[model samples]
Target: MNFAKILRACKGMQWQLSREYAFKSDLKIKWVRPEKIPCTKPEKSGDLGKLPPVNEKEFLLDYKDSRELQSADPIVQSLFQLGNNRCADTARYLREQLIKEVQRHPLDYGSMEAKLARMTVRIRIMQDELEQYPRNTKLKVALKELIDKRKKFLKYLRRWDYRRFEWMLEKLDLVYKPPPAEFHWITRKESLQKLTDAHCEKIKEERLAEYRNMLDEQKIPFLEDAIKKMEFVRKEQIDLEIPVSVTEEQIKDFKRELEALKSKREVKVDSKK
Candidate 1:
């Protein structure tokens, strides 16, 4: 291995450690997640092509190179095109479309937008290649580097001129995600804890709803008993000529509420059936 490669590796390790410490210390700034967090997310965006890396519409050689001849005779098509280097032709076409308006001059290829456009073409092609041969580590590494480089360019563009950055994103249909202030590992323990908490929350909500239904059921029976008892007491009070505090209006209201609840419960039961 090259000494420079080892040195770079050491630096990378040190950087990761510092980031991890920042995460563990819990003083990092809160980043507003651009998208909802799914139950499972990759360790990093680049690995496994998880970047959700900008969507690119492939430029087809059939359209760019031989659009007029596509509807022409088979003999004419065969004579006009050999059907080789189509991938390269498509990449060139896409690159031109991306950089045509953004380039500083006709000869400009090193501008930020120009480089980004070129990288985007390469990234798109490589991702396509990866789809066929997922075990190609070399291609995967190159693709990851290309993706990371594009991200860096986008980040710089965002800071330098946010308006241009927005325009660039719109043009490329790319989502620019800022580096997270804190990096937390998705450990088994942490994932299980989150899932367990979610499961418990669901169960708690279900149980609470059931408890509420039970209380509701009790209300009808309780109201029936209370009405019977109250009517008996009122009869006795009238017979003894005693003063009454339980008003007829109060009993009527209770009965009305009880009827409404009983009707609602019956509707639910009928629906279930």
Candidate 2:
């Protein structure tokens, strides 16, 4: 196997076996075949970075910014109410503790205050997660696309970072790993696959050409002999005649059986006489 050619074929395009030699020029001239390549209308570019990564903080902000949900979605609002209740309960508990501490003659409760502060932040994070679930999903998609466009750049950087002395050792076989979720357009998938398919097709065509050449040079005589034997068998089958070229063992066995039968017949004739 030609490793470089195989890798290129696997990564870049679809592959198919072809008998014709015109494919040699096709590889140089096209990234994808015209028929296999999908025609797509250009999408209007939008500011992508405006969409932040899908985290708790980003989710909350996205929900707050949405036109339909300025007041917040009912489900998110319910979570927010539950979070607020928890906060009130915690604050009330702290206040009671503070009162008890004062009663016990305490003016310093740094540890208790810190605990309440931490509790408040945790509650807020939970609230954000509940409110921003949908917005987070949308932003995640946008962020994923941003990451995809930069993937080649990222791969190059990784290779560069890993490079020690030998450049070949640092080379990584990077494959496109799209987000493990749905996309707005299936055509994007089709296009990516088209490029992949074209590459595969080139490799297959090359390999098939190689195989046919090998068969002609090395294996065709054996195949021809098998074909001739099949033809001879077919002729014998149609004629119901014994083959002229029998194996030596088969001929010997047949001659032995015939001689035994002839001797038996001669004995019967002698007895009748």
Candidate 3:
């Protein structure tokens, strides 16, 4: 036969053999096309380059200076009356007291003592007013603000001069409680330690789980065989020349004998040297 005819005969024979094998075998061959995964669009970046302008009213509400409170608020005049009895006109007396406390060479309004005194007076007046007008939300808010301001001053005083701070608290009849030690900010060391501990714990749990799974996956017969060997060793099979069940006393004695043998061997080696 020609080469092309011979090739056709071989191919036909192979096809027949494949059909016969498919009919006989229980196994079936299948071709599956993979499903396509959908792609998601990337999120657009926000315009973070330009920040919004700060609201002046909101800023003043939170961080108003004592001087700002002086002429603008009648509450300051009332606060002054509660703390002092020097002058009949509360506003004038308040101004005079502030100036005296300041004792600035240039008579500037930015004085630590004067600010603290103002905040103390405000806190006392607010507390009294709040007791009277318990239902007033505005009064309650104002009182909370005054208390916060006073606490800030107290913090400064405690840091700068504890003796002066105590004296001031006594003079004002103010109860001062220090802020909590825990702050919003975290130190690098603390952050690293926390992360390290968490990572180590996670890794340890994962490793333990993996080891447990590995032990579980071992064939039952393999485990049975190992247990049998251990049991045989524990029983001290005479034919195997293995020791019987080892007691605490026997283990201790064995350890001592091993140590003595080690020492004697070392001595013999030294003598040879």
Give the TM-scores of the predictions, in the order they appear: 0.57, 0.17, 0.30
**Candidate that beats the other on TM-score, 2 or 3, i.e. the better one:** 3
The prediction achieving the highest TM-score against the true structure is: 1
Q: Pick the candidate with the highest lDDT.
A: 1
Top-down lDDT ranking = 1, 3, 2
Residue runs of model 1 more than 4 Å from their true location after superposition: 1-86, 101-111, 224-256
Say which prediction, candidate 1 or candidate 2, comes out ahead on TM-score: 1
- Show model 2 residue runs off by greater than 4 Å: 1-189, 220-243, 246-273
The weakest ten consecutive residues by lDDT in model 1 span: 38-47
Error of 1 at 76 (Å): 8.7
Better of 1 and 3 by TM-score: 1
Which one wins by lDDT: 1 or 3? 1
What total of clashing residue pairs does each candidate reach? 0, 16, 0
lDDT of 2 by residue, 128-215 (tens): 3534563565544544444344444444544565442122212221222334466554465476557668888989999998787565
Model 1 / residue 35 / CA error / Å: 19
For model 2, state the Cα shift of residue 119 in Å: 73
Residue 254 lDDT in model 1?
81
